[model samples]
Target: MTTALDTTDRRARQVRQALWIGFALQLAVALVPLIDLVTFDSITEHVRAAYPDWSADDVALDRNAITWSLVGIGALGCVGWLIALALAKRPTASRITVTALFALGLVTSLTLLSMGGEGYDLVVPLAHGLFTLLPLLAGLTAVVAVWQRRR
Candidate 1:
């Protein structure tokens, strides 16, 4: 017969598994920004198109800044995921951290999305915007998995 201990152990295993899956997804998403950095030359035209008034040197500087910003954001997100994973055995702490991270990700993504052609006058390439938002999936999964009630 299945005892409460057995059920709790199974649930803990499931939570850890879910945390690992979230970490994997987060790591994969983190690479997207690095890939963009590797192919920085290809994005120059898009940046130029967005800010036609900017000089060649200006464009280069802006592109570098944008790419690096995305990379930094991705790296920080990966770190947060790792922290959540590390705390997975402590379900309350893990859930709280994951939920907070998810909220932060949502806010960051939305802020980035709203930051173009208006007050900020910064136009990010479509790929960059998407890259910024991709971590939400990872964060969301972790949040849901950790917060799920024991069955």
Candidate 2:
């Protein structure tokens, strides 16, 4: 009962949905870093507690640097996802956007994983681990869904 055009429309809709979900996930990832920027004092306290010998001043500085880095990266992710969302209707642009998002997701995830030992604090580790995995899942899903569609 479904014409070719109907099938195409369905696939397009699915791709659009996937891209938007990916955008939302990326937005969540972006917000997590902003949250860190605001609650960094608690993180510093955790780090200071874990490393007694480390000065509070030093811990605070390190925490600030980490939080800033995350914020910057997260902002970049938001931009990438926004671009992808905007281009979702154009097959080539969509593919490029999807690929870029996947690459960013991979880099971001790996970077977060590499910082696993730095979590020192329970909250830090948990937040970092969860955010890292989430982006990877969302990016992969978006890429696969888009890739499988007929252009």
RMSD of each: 2.6, 3.4
lDDT of each: 0.70, 0.69
Off by over 4 Å in 2: 36-42, 115-126, 149-151
Model 1 superposed RMSD (Cα): 2.6
Error of 1 at 30 (Å): 3.3
Question: For every model shown, what is its TM-score relative to the native structure?
Answer: 0.81, 0.77
Candidate 1 lDDT over 1-151, as tens digits, reads: 8887777677667766766766666666667656766775645676777777889998888777776776677677778778877887887788788788789878877776667763234566665676666657656666666777756
| Model 2 Cα lDDT, one tens digit per residue, 60-143 | 776776666666776777787778778888878888878977886797666666554543534344555467567667677778
**Which regions in candidate 1 have their CA more than 4 angstroms from the true location?**
40-42, 117-122
Best by lDDT: 1
Candidate 1, position 59, lDDT: 84
lDDT of 2 at 93: 81
